[model samples]
Target: MEILKKSQSGSFESSDIIILIEPVEPNSGRNIDIDSSVMLEYGDTIKALITSKLDSYNISDIHLIAKDKGALELTINARLETAIKRACNIQKATMH
Candidate 1:
């Protein structure tokens, strides 16, 4: 999983799960639904989903910084996956 250059820090560790969250408006994308806007209070739900998705991997440390663009749960998930893949340096996953 340490395929990419160790970001400014050192080797990636799975024990570390860094999460940064920011608030955003709604209607940022076509895939995003306004009803899912309940993410404000349900942010932990998104975190849990992403964590679950990354749980099976060999990633020891994960640093997830999210910029909410008024998107829904699905959009958030897509963006998070993109970020994680980018962090791990998966060349093919960067097609986004």
Candidate 2:
């Protein structure tokens, strides 16, 4: 996302959204925190997608941080969407 400013303590402006990626730790029975790239788009599609997905999955605590890479408008959005879904185990499990 176009970060006009950065916050060190998870403090974001009205224009920014925070995503938390919480995955269960194997054998440890604990959760791991992961961050996603910030999404940059004029529209609210990215935020909407992330909000819906996060709510649907009921994930918490894990923090996500995203940095734009000059992707197509939808590229970053799609990437984040894919990343979240995959991280939440909604996507088909693949061997890679």
Candidate 3:
């Protein structure tokens, strides 16, 4: 889904991550930045996870800022997905 506006998810709490995303010009490519307490140990891993998640959504033109506080993979996944949904103007899933 296309990013309609800037959106954020998660928190600065321990073992959590905050994901902030902003819309960029079409076809401009992704600008994924990472800030983590474990940067020296898992920087590449975090970047890969974020890149894979963005790719899954086919989001090529966005500026994503991931601030991590030693969160696990699952948390990262969830936060990023939630941020994407919010940026796309989705409040919640609809049920039929």
Candidate 4:
């Protein structure tokens, strides 16, 4: 399931994260840009978490822009999933 359009979730509020998702051309691969207060400590981990979620959905052609406000792993997972679902016009939580 590839992202169909630009979609976003979360906010810039403290302890939260804002995620923006957009579709990319087929075979262009996935691109994720992350900006976070904890980048120095958790950059690679965040990217891996995001990549794992995307892989779970079999999504490869997309671009993600994420600005984190010191959010936890669970929060990041939730916001990212929400943004992806929104981009794909999905209503339920049947993530797959």
> Which residue pairs clash in candidate 2?
1-38, 35-64, 36-65, 37-66, 38-66, 38-67
- Tell me the spans in candidate 3 whose CA falls farther than 4 Å from its real position: 94-96
**Per-prediction TM-score:** 0.49, 0.38, 0.92, 0.92
Taking all chains together, the TM-score of candidate 3 against the true structure is: 0.92
Per-candidate alpha-carbon RMSD to the true structure: 13.8, 11.4, 2.8, 3.0
The C-alpha lDDT values of all candidates are 0.43, 0.41, 0.91, 0.90
1-96: candidate 2 lDDT, tens digit per residue: 111121222123333333334343333332323332433343355445545555555544334444333334455445555556655555566431
Q: Model 2, clash count?
A: 6
How far residue 32's Cα lies from its native spot in candidate 4, in Å, is: 0.8
Q: Cα RMSD for candidate 2?
A: 11.4
Tally clashes: model 3: 0
Candidate 3 lDDT score at position 35: 95
Q: Rank the candidates by TM-score, best first.
A: 4, 3, 1, 2
